[model samples]
Target: MQQIINFLIRNKTFITYLVLLFIALGLTFNAHSYHNTKFVNSANRITGGVYNTTDAISDYFHLKEYNEQLVKENRELRSKLFNTPASSTERAQLPPGDSLQERFKVYPATVIKNSYSKERNYLLVDRGSRDSVGQDMGVITSQGLVGIIENTSSGYATVQSILNTLSEINASVKNTNNFGSLRWDGNAPDVVQLVDILRAAPIKEGDTIITGGMSSIFPKGVPIGTIRDFTLDISENYYIINVALFNDMTTLDHVYIIENLDREEILNLENTTNEQ
Candidate 1:
């Protein structure tokens, strides 16, 4: 205590000067409106900068969640685009002779896994037996045809991609309805081959191709793609069509699964007749 008192006594002059200086500065700012305003503005500027920095850091941390939200939104949009129902007006007014109509059920699912690099590509979907998904169900995206569901678990399903060598889609000409078989070349990821289409069937470069409705997999009139090019075979009976698929097989995301409601009954009926 005595040493502290001695030191205070030694620096009393300096301490008093420092005290007076601080008081003077305080009075100057308090007395002058301009100085007070300038001080307040400087304080606000510092606080705003701190707030913006914190906000930026928080936003950076939430990027992944935001991206997931975007993916979900995209999935919903595709669902709406592909699965539109019959409007009330359309349902009330059926054409007199529209008897051969086939209805399709669309089930929306997300791709949990995918493979494009392999010779026989397959995709894993986030829906399966629990969701009523089963073997032979067709899978497609907004852009175009995808594949068929080959295997299923309670909560997941695997699809045989259209890129697979063994994959086949019953297809037909869009307008003429002359049918053909769609197969993958196993070389090009984007290009597929359509065989058994007669050369004299009014085939053109931009002619549309769609599901043939001959099998239970895909319903009729589902747009597969358009003819990119074609060449007559050596036999010269049918044209080998090079199809440019509408879907970007490498960038697949949300897909719609199709269920043919009457498939089982129809198949059973056919099987019984064949047995008889």
Candidate 2:
């Protein structure tokens, strides 16, 4: 306390002069509109520079998520290169009957949080309302189908993982018309079971399974995985077939949000027919 007092006393003259100088400067700026504007601008520039530097430091912690997003974008580009035309102009020249829900745009996003070890596991994606994402949109990685969007915020979205209890996908045996419901029974880390397929259906041990396009979320030919095993249910009307998922749900990182263009139209049409 004594040191502070001595220091204040020693600097009293200089401190008084500084205080008077600040008062004079403040008065000058208040009297002149031009000086006031200049002062305000200069203060804003200094504070903005400091704020920008702080923001840059904070953003450094998000590098992993950003890199994952980059990988997803790269995969989308590759998918378009291999399958879809590079530009809309090129597609305009193609045959008229090529339109479908799969031809719609896919936005890339990173899976910040993923789960597959539980009975009703869900995944959290980093894209959300700000990126035009909404509930019920299909989310999938490059390897295979993943899940559907369940909820969204300004900067994030939660997906109902394929491993969830309520998750359902329309699938069929490759090269045959045997369609069934794909569900996870809370077992098998890398496998899901196909149910409701008739026992009479000729399902080989290694028969391929794929999205049936019965629902508009996935394209018809999008490759799922192959069958691993099978067993008859107690009623014997259907067979329980094991499916080895192409995309490992446990190790997922990046994914695409598929926006089915004709989904609403088809749904509305189906409702109209049901009401008849």
Candidate 3:
């Protein structure tokens, strides 16, 4: 206590000068409108700077939650795209109460594991059977297709990446009827091979490739990639196209799993017909 008193006494003159300086500054600010306005403006700037720094930190911490929300929103938007109405002529040919929504459903999933360096690369996603994700469902990202769901547990699933050697998807030239089988050569992660396209098809180097929708897997028009190059095969009957994938297989994160609601019925009917 005595040390504190001595310290205060020793600094009394400087302390008094500091107090008077503040009081004089306050009086000047109050007496002059310009000074008051300048002080208020300065104070506001300092407060705003502090608030901006704090808000930036807060937003940085919430980025993951924001990203998940964006993924969900994207899934909803894709669902709407799949359910959009057809042209007047197409709608007229449909049955009385049929809609596109009855055939397809989309759900969001996060990729927990990804491998693209291997020939048989597979991806693990956070969604599983519990989330309505099942075997043979198509998985895609906002940029392009990812893979097909192979196996599912209660809370997780495995995806056969488009880069896998065993993977095969029906794909076609965008805006045209030329269709082929999409496959990987087990060599390049960014490129896949599209075979069985007729030689006469009007294929260009930069032409876009999309899902064919011939099977019950992916919907029609889902973007796959662009044709990087093409050449005639050994037999020269078809063009083997090299497609540059839109999605970077090594950097996959958020994905959407698509389910064909009528897949079972379609498969059952086909099976019955085949029995005959």
Candidate 4:
């Protein structure tokens, strides 16, 4: 305590000057409108900067949650779009007492494994038989089609990717009758080939391609991709088309699985006819 008193006595002159300086500055700020205004502005800017920095940090940490929410919302929208009737004409064509419920069901799944650089690339999703996922269900992302479900276990499923050489899907030109089988050449990851479209079909480099909806898998008009290039076959009767996919195969994350309620009925009827 005596040491403290000695130190305070030694610095008394300097301490008195520092206190007077602060008092004078405060008096000037309070007495002068311009000084007060400048001080308030400076304080506001500092506070605002702090708040902005804090907000940015909070948002960065919440990105994964935001992405999951967006995926869930997209799943709901896809279910509504596929389940709803396509047009007024189709709605009118419904049988007299038919309900307006959608024929296709949609479920969201996350990709647990993916392969793009192989002759037969496959994807594994987090949903399986326990989630009601089964073989032959079509999978897609928000941008475009992905693949079809191949095998399923209790908690996981394998998807036959569109990039696989053995993969074949029924596809067609948007807003036209020209249709073909979509296949991959096992060479390019972003491009696929379409075969069996007639030469006379009106197609161009940028024409849009979509699901033909002839099968029991995908509903009609699900976007596939845009035509990048095409050429007439040696026979000159059909065109071999090169399509640029919309989805980046190397960066797949969330996907939707589509279950066609009428698939079994349709397949059974076709098989019966074949036997006859």
Candidate 5:
């Protein structure tokens, strides 16, 4: 206490001057309208700047939550889209047993690990059996197809990336029955090969490619890529098309897993037929 008193007494002159200076400034600003307006404007600017900075920091921290919410909404929308019949006429023409609704289910997931350089590259996603993800489910992004779910654990699953050399998907040129097998040459990250498409399919450069709906895994019309170039094999019976992928396999993040509700039944019937 004595030390504080001594220090205050020693700085009394300076403290008095500082107090008077602040008082005088306040009086001057209050007495002059222009000064008062300028002071208020300056204070507002400082506070507004501070608030903006704080809001930006808060938004940055909430980005992950916002992304998850968006993914959920997208999953719902896609589920509806997949269930919708192509046309009301088509729906009426179909038998009640084959209602398009409830044919597929969509599950959203995040990529935890990705590989595109390896010959049999795979991606690990943050979804698994617990989330209803299963082996052979088709995975895709908003831009295009990713791959098929290969393995699963309680909380995670692996995707056999479409870039894998062993990957084979049924794909077709958009708006046509010209279908082919989509495979990777393990040579380029952005390009894959679509083999066995008949040369007379009226296809050209820049043609769009999509799933053929021939398998129970992926639905038809899901995007795969666009044709970049083509060449005839030695047999010249079919086209070897180079397709530029719409999705950058090297930068996968969020993905959706698609489950065909009738997959098991279809497979079982086919198995029984084959046995016969």
Candidate 6:
């Protein structure tokens, strides 16, 4: 206590001067409108800058949550788009009296692992059987198809990427009955091959390709890729087409997994018919 009293007494003059200076400045600011206005403006600017910096930091931390919300909204929109009736821009025609109620269900997932540079490549996603994903379910992005679900656990699934040599999908040229089998040559990550497209269909360079809806996996009219080039096979009976994929397999992030509600019923009926 004596040391504190000694220090205060020694600095009394300086402390008095500082106190008087602050009082004088306050009186001056209050007495003059211009000084008061300037002080207020400076205070506001400092506070505003602090608020802006804090807001930016908050937004940065919430980016993942915002991204997930966007993914969910996109998934809902796609569900509506795929379950609608056939239109001129979509499918050529629909089966008579076919109601497309709940035809496809979409689930959003993130790619946990990806591979594109091999004869056989696969992807691991953050969805699983618990998310209603199953084997043979089609996986796609907003741009194009990714692959089919090969296996699944409770919390994860593996996709057989379209770049795999063993991957085969049913695809067709848009707005036509011309269909072919989509396959990968494992030569390029961005390109795949479509085989068995008959030459009778009107085909040209840069034509759009889409799912053929031949099977219960992918729905009709889902965009696949564009025709880069095409040539007739040895016998000239069919065209072997080189397709530039819409989805860059090397740069995958989020994907949607599709479940065909009628898949089980169709497979059961076909099996019964074959046994007869």
Please give each candidate's TM-score. Answer: 0.65, 0.66, 0.68, 0.68, 0.68, 0.67
Determine the backbone clash count of candidate 4. 0
The best-first sequence of candidates by lDDT reads 4, 5, 3, 6, 1, 2
**TM-score attained by model 1:** 0.65
Worst 10 residues of 1 by lDDT: 34-43
Candidate 2 residues 1-276, lDDT tens each?
999999999999999999999987886665343112223221123443454455457557867865876688688877776786558657656775577423666898877666788776767676778889877788876677898887676666777777876778899998899999998888876889899999899988888898897987776766678999999999989999999988877767668898887878988999999999
Residues 78-191, candidate 1: write the lDDT tens digits.
887667666844653677444443456789986656678877777777677888898889998766799998767666677888888778889998978799899988888888
Clashes in model 4: which pairs? none
Alpha-carbon local distance difference test for all models: 0.77, 0.76, 0.81, 0.82, 0.81, 0.80
Q: Runs in model 1 with CA error above 4 Å?
A: 1-88, 92-102
Those runs of model 3 whose alpha carbons end farther than 4 Å from true positions after fitting are: 1-98
Give residue 154's lDDT in candidate 6 (0 to 100). 66
Clash pairs detected, candidate 1: none
Evaluation by lDDT, superior candidate among 2 and 4: 4
Of the two candidates 2 and 5, the one with more favorable TM-score, higher being better, is 5
Off by over 4 Å in 4: 1-100
- The sequence of per-residue lDDT tens digits that candidate 4 reaches over residues 80-108 is 77787779657657775464446788999
Assess the local accuracy of residue 132 in candidate 2 as a C-alpha lDDT between 0 and 100: 90
Model 5 lDDT tens row, 116-167 = 9877776777677888888899999977999998767667676788998778
lDDT of 2 at 197: 99
User: 5 or 6, which is superior by lDDT?
Assistant: 5
Backbone collision count in every prediction?
A: 0, 0, 0, 0, 0, 0
- The reply for model 2, stretches above 4 Å from the true place, is 1-103
